[model samples]
Target: VASKSNLSLVGGNFTLQDATLSASSGQINLVSVASKGEIIPERGELGVQTPNISNFTKLGHIEMINSRAETTGSPSGGISIRGDQFWMDNSSIHADNLGDTDGKYIDIQTNESIQIQGKYFGVISNSFGKGDAGHIFINTPYLKIDQGTIDTSTKGEGNGGNIDIKATKIDVIEGGIIASDSYSTGNGGDINITATESLSVTDKRIFLTPEQADFTSTIGSASLDKGNGGRTTINTGQLIMDGAAISSNSHVSGDAGEILINADSIDMINGGTMTATVMSQSSGQGGSVTLNVKEKIYITGFRPGLSFTTTDVFENLQSAIVLITFGTGNAGNVNLLAKELVVDNNASIATATTGLGDAGNLTIEVDNLYVNNGGFISNSSGGIIGGKIFPGFGPAGTLKITANNEIVVSGQGAFSASGLLTNTLVSAPGGNIEIQTNKLTLADGGTISADSLGTGDAGTLDIKANTINLTDGGNITTSSAYAAGGNIAVTTSGLLFLRDGQITTSVGTGVGKGGDITIDNPIFIVMDGGKIKAQADAGHGGNINVKSNQFISSPDSLISASSKLGIDGQVRIDSPDMDMAGFLVILPGGFVEASMQNCNTRDGSSFKVSPRQRTVPFENKN
Candidate 1:
């Protein structure tokens, strides 16, 4: 089982315990060398005598047990180990290529430490037929794997190989698996990890083996049918995960890969999961998850099994750290570039779609963005069951958040773009929630939503801030039922504050209509029980614009445009300075206007103000 062999063993210390080394069908080399000292000069000495090379404390330590090293068939050539220190507990290293060729390559170099522990340790390069599958290079300063398995697999049509690791320090505990798998049509492989200082994936407590009790620690890739899924790159300075999981998946029609992470600091606690998926009988598409952290990123949540005197508050929650995607094509993008981003307790960053494509796009570039307790950043799409004779649509995706300085959403945190309701069909719209911030804060029951129920339409909600704060029961919404209803734009340069917060656009019983609500501020304040709304039940109702220099409202605050069966909307206030003692309303054809005037006082004296108008008409129910 050898072809073109090269074996060298000149040692001072080299050990192989239960050995079985086969260089099957290839160019083989099994080498171990550490011995140098040949100098005898005393007869030609005269100002030239140099001979001293002796430093051996059992030089170049390497130990292998229950061993098996293999390269079996076709263009094969692999197996290399050069060491200062390397220990394999229950070893099995294979470079397998049986049918279509190409498979065999493994280079491991160690200067200080590398330890592979038990449970039948394996390092494999596999391919069933049609070529491809090989390459696994590791360079280490310190690397440890407790329950090991490093694999590259392919079932038939080839392709699947490439696992490069360079370490300063790396640890994979528990059931440890670093994998690349492609089952049928091939293609799936590529995992590069470079750790300059620290990288850890944990789980593994005291080995009480109940099948290792839910052992985690995994770095993966899998493509099942038409095959096409790879790419998982991590460049770390510090990355820590507790229950560990990093995945890339595609189940049927392929396409689902890409996960790039560059870290200076990243911490994912207990139920850690970072995934990119395209399943539900995939049609392709659904990948891309990028995280570039220069300073900090912490996604927390972890409760082993509820203790500390727990009385089962839903089993004491906390076990979340997820960046997810699910699909039928489309449902994959999540890019977070952070300086400081913290997502607490029920952590989540999601992109979802149930079937017909669309639903992916969540970008967060942070200087400082914190989402508290019930955290969530979502983009959703899925609904349409009965009804739709010829309606084909796919919309629901978009959430862009940029915080250059500060953005905080407290407690029941949520930022969503949703479309999932299908009674009379025509479903497909709901996406768009853009936020640009310098300072924006939403307290307590924080929520930002864009929703469309069926007949398509309901999206826009844009916020640009210099300073904007919504207190207590914070809420910002865009709603629709049989269509149209979505548009709420607020641009603030200095101050806009809403106390018991609420900003809405709504429509319910069919025929569409009910959207507009715009506020541009220099200084606008609504007190105690703040509210700004545009509502309609059967149709038309929208329009409430306020441009402020100074506009303050207090008695219980309220500015509304309402309709019960049809038309009624429009409430405009352009302020120079106004203190509305409380409510402003419009009921039928709408119209509640405010314009105050006369001011010239720096000694010329002319101060007068009085302007408030209203118009209303009922009965318009068609």
Candidate 2:
């Protein structure tokens, strides 16, 4: 590397294609005013330590055409420019595999404007255990880069640098890529951009087209990398990129910084994801963002969690939100008052911790909300959706799910929350709403469950396991009074119904003698297989408490003279020869099952029965 020639020039428009520029074997410098030239070495090498060139002052249009750089041999560099309006076209530049030689691929220290068009400037640092650096610094406030295949690549675990512009506007369009590059930021500017103009993307691809690139070492392989964000402010006027990427920056070791964006209009037609992120040491936040988006906002990627936060808190009452666990969690408290919010099952929006605060309070005031192929809005079961506060405070947050499409809520993996329905159809042809558990209570409609269960306590609890369970884990609570029309509640340790389900109301612990087993309309209370056992009882050891479970027991306190068992429907206790009334006794609807297995009584009050056996008000037996 010491036995090398150093070619030096002053200024001129130069073209270098198919040439080998070696900083480890040769050194070439250009210090000219107006030298229009070319360095297309068909089979030769040009060595130059660009930063080593002493040209504090120079006025020239130096152009670097298509070429390859091999500078990973010593503490030398490939290309360094401090000129006016320097340009590098359809070319490639990089250095790798020579150990820590303090080798840099390209250094642009120019204080004037610069443009990288139709060029593929690549870099790979620390290849084969070697370190590397690269850049195209626009020290001045003037730099324009639009169009090209800039595959800023890094191989092994080392990252190579390229494009370091602190300029005004950056327009990216056509076939431009920041592909095959990695980044680091323990110190320097991984990708520093402080533009006062616009930064927009049109029809472009930033991160490489999903062609997998392998790492060298099992741990630290890649040498170079793609672009990064050095606390950038992408202005709407400064950037008009159809496609581009803010690749990984590894040097910082810490999380990446925030990026402020001000775009007038954007339309993400297809492919490419808008991956905007921020790193909080303990709890970091991003700058304020506002986009007058006209087209669809396609948020895709593994890390598609975009967020904006500040220490500023909104105060009204007692509690305050100090930290937001997830970015999309704000969506539950934040109102999305758009004209339309359609969630295609094909398009999923997920959150880690606090997915959504409360669909209730997070007013999604849209003209329409369509969930084609099953779209869902959920929240953490532990997350709070505070109730409405009148004089003191506390109001129930609400989730208004209006849909022209079907709103079916019945799955093993269901979220914990309440919903208010405007116009809901439950049944075939209209749309079905199935509830596997009675944990739900609709304000108006929406939850018009048409399940097979005749009992509504569960509003639908259709579990058929060897044993049922409602342990410390899962909950089934109703905060406010939905309505006092004709809703019922059932809590039987035994199966409520083997044929249907239970839509019980009473909750907490020992709340009601049992949910108001109301007989509003013509209802059927068939004790065919199971019995309705309530913690409430008049006497005789019936633990059926009337009021308990924390809150006030429902006003099941009937005023008029109605049967405790309003049986307009059939009460066929068809436990034939088993003498069912011995076990299935009702305050209302009287006893209507068979007398006894081997005997009959005139009083019809007391009767004996065998163990584990009962009678059913079998069909045609009433």
Q: lDDT of all predictions, in order shown? A: 0.71, 0.31
User: For all the candidates, what are their Cα RMSDs to the real structure?
Assistant: 20.4, 21.8
Best by lDDT: 1
Over 160-224, each residue of candidate 2 has an lDDT whose tens digit, in order, gives 44444455555444433333333432222233444565544433222322232111000011111
- Tens-place lDDT per residue, model 1, 280-332, is 66777767889998999887675354211100112222333222334457767
How well does each candidate superpose onto the true structure, as a TM-score?
0.44, 0.38
Poorest lDDT segment (10 consecutive residues) of candidate 1: 306-315
TM-score of 1: 0.44
Worst 10 residues of 2 by lDDT: 214-223
